[model samples]
Target: MGIIDNLEAMRAKGQDSALMRYSLGNEYLKQEQTDQAIEHLAEATGQDPNYSAAWKLYGKALTQASRYAEAVEALNRGIEVAEAKGDAQAVKEMRVFLKRAQSALDASG
Candidate 1:
C-alpha cells in the first residue's frame, strides 16, 4: 500500500500520533508532493502544537510552495513554543529557520 493509504488507515484507527503524521509528511516531501506534505504536517502540528520538528517541516513545505508569509508565521510560532517550553535545542534550530523565513520575506518584498 502507498504511504498515504497507510497514513489514512492509521488515522482511521484513531492513531493520531504526531510522529506518525510527521513521518508521513516526510515521505510525501521526499516524493516532492508538497501539498500532501503540508496537509500531513499540518495535522501533525495540530495533534501536538508544541512539536517543533513538525513546525519546522511545515515551514519548509510552505516555503517551497512559495507561501512565504505563512512560512514565516509557522516558524515564528515554532520559535515561541520552543522558547516557552525551554527546549533549548529546538529553540536554536527554530531561530535558524526563522532567520531563513525572514530573509525570504525580505527578498520577496
Candidate 2:
C-alpha cells in the first residue's frame, strides 16, 4: 500500500494521531481525492480542535468537493481556532479563505 493507504489503515486501527491524519489528508489532496482528504483532515481537526492548519486544509477539501457551505463553516471554525490561539497570521489567512468560501457559496445559490 501507498503511504496514504498505510496512514488510513493506521487511522482505522485507532491510531488517532493528528499529525498522521493531516499528513494522510495532504497526500489525498495531492491525489485529488477531496472526499478522503476531507475525511482525514476533519479527523485531524477533531483530534486537535486548536489546529488551525488542519481546519484550513479541511475547508479547502470541502471547497474542492463543491461543498461550499461546509467549506465556509470549516473556514469559520479555522478562523476561530486561530484567533483563540493568538495566531495573527493564521487568523488572517483563514479569514481570506473564509471569505472566498462564502463567496463561492453565495454564487452557487
lDDT on C-alpha atoms for all candidate structures: 0.87, 0.89
Give the TM-score (vs. native) of candidate 2: 0.89
- C-alpha displacement of 78 in model 1, angstroms? 0.5
Per-residue accuracy of model 2 over 12-101 as CA lDDT, tens digit each: 897878899899899999999888898889989999998999998899899889899999999999988888889899888878888888
- What ranges in model 2 sit over 4 Å off? 12-14
TM-score of model 1 (CA atoms): 0.84
Best by lDDT: 2
Q: For residues 1-109, what per-residue lDDT tens digits would candidate 1 score against the true structure?
A: 9877898788889887899999989998989999999998998999999898898889888888888899999988888888888888987887787788788889999
lDDT of 1: 0.87
The parts of candidate 1 lying over 4 Å away from their true place are 2-5
